[model samples]
Target: MPPSPVVPCHSPVPDPSLYEPINTLKPVVPDVWIADGPVVRMAMPCGLSMPFTTRMTIVRLRDGGLWCHSPIAPDDALFAAIDALGPVRDLVSPNQLHYAHIAAWKRRYPHAVARASPGVSERAAAQDIEARFDAAFDDAAPSPWPGEIDPLLFRGSRAFGEVVFFHRASATLVLADLIENFEKEKLTRGMRAVARLGGVLDPDGKAPLDMRMTFTDRGAARDCLRQLLAWKPQRVLLAHGRWYERDGVEQLQRAFRWLE
Candidate 1:
């Protein structure tokens, strides 16, 4: 028997009209849309902080397929935008704990494949939702992105698994819930103090704390970090907080300094 279905904590959806359509030609990292034919990166700004803040990324495959890294409950307008773009090919629950809107996405896109980490199967089963994956991410796991992207599983801790994705064509790395970048003024006073103490805040004001908590074994994390660094990606797309542009690999090294 599967574990009981876990209903995600509910939150109101943000109005889409409030967001201005960002021109992709610009070079802003936070809400920049990078597209190369069928491969499109839509940087939707989240309401994590006031005055246009983004905490997650929604990637669109060539077939108009959608894949989200972070959980943001898709409202009608959001779904319409997704529909306008193309069909949602897959929904990935990168870690065990981040399945906030998997069920809803499954309902919305019934044909879309729902892939999750090891424990996600039971959670999906409990909810009576069917999830399909080519394989669970093991060491050096392969992604199902049809040669467009590759996934490397960073194994070292049991609390959660962080599957890192590398988009080959764009030389961009997609990370989930691992690194966070929040401006101090945008965060609440309490959060600011905690982030500062956690060494999440970089000199450029980026936060990597989201990825730091999952490392039960530093050795494993260090090895994974080393492997990821070898890719030499130019852009870093993260699920939480902000994405890094230029010197992404160096920023990643700085964030995972425990490995050093």
Candidate 2:
């Protein structure tokens, strides 16, 4: 038989709205506020109207400079708001799949370093997206988070390339779509049904999908889950769902029940 045809997986090109500047900011939780002033955190209603809330973390550097992670596209008003924070210093596309507005942000913050994800270079190139990251995550290496944060690559599995981050000072664990916890009522009708059928939702909220279907090796995934359990975080922040305030470690364990 002839060699199997190579099926190219193209990177998704986000819509124009993704780059639009933030017009308002709101606090979804105490201490954790959404900067909609020039950068809004939009709730992405995906999968049968299931609302997956995404956030853009904007920080004002000590040197009167600003930095943003998972930035949206630039708007004149949003640029002004970002300018007020300080000069743009860095733009981070934290994961390969989260590079929607990276190109626009890079254009606006020309002086800012664009930190790309591990597989971004090849994936972006395939889509003709000319963006690059200054640093990439190494599964075995330590993260350079200015001594304030640490990152660990949840390797041993090929289903998803996830690098979980830990903010030391705040004792916050940031996850990138590895887990979710939104209530079904908060989602659209279609999404609610899907969540119900998937057994990802309960009266309290939706849980993370086991996602074992995507894993190339179950053993590897199980090992990574074990490592995550060892972290013992106080608070868990998910990229696609509600944040876990207390007893985060238990919640994590419950979400990954398949590994047990």
TM-score of candidate 2 versus the correct structure, residues matched by position: 0.70
Evaluate residue 110 in candidate 1 and report its C-alpha lDDT on the 0 to 100 scale: 80
TM-score to true structure, per model? 0.69, 0.70
Clash counts for the predictions, in order: 4, 5
Q: Candidate 1: where are CA atoms >4 Å away?
A: 1-54, 62-64, 121-141, 202-216
TM-score, cand. 1 vs. native: 0.69
Per-residue accuracy of model 2 over 1-260 as CA lDDT, tens digit each: 99999989795653332222234333333323234222223332342334444556554434545546666545677677666656877676666656767778777777788777667677788878767566676666655556555666665445456666665555666665566554554566666676666556643332345454456676777787776667677877655545677787787777777555
lDDT of 1 by residue, 23-128 (tens): 1122333323332111122222221322223333456665556665543455666667567666777676776644556777778888877667767677667866
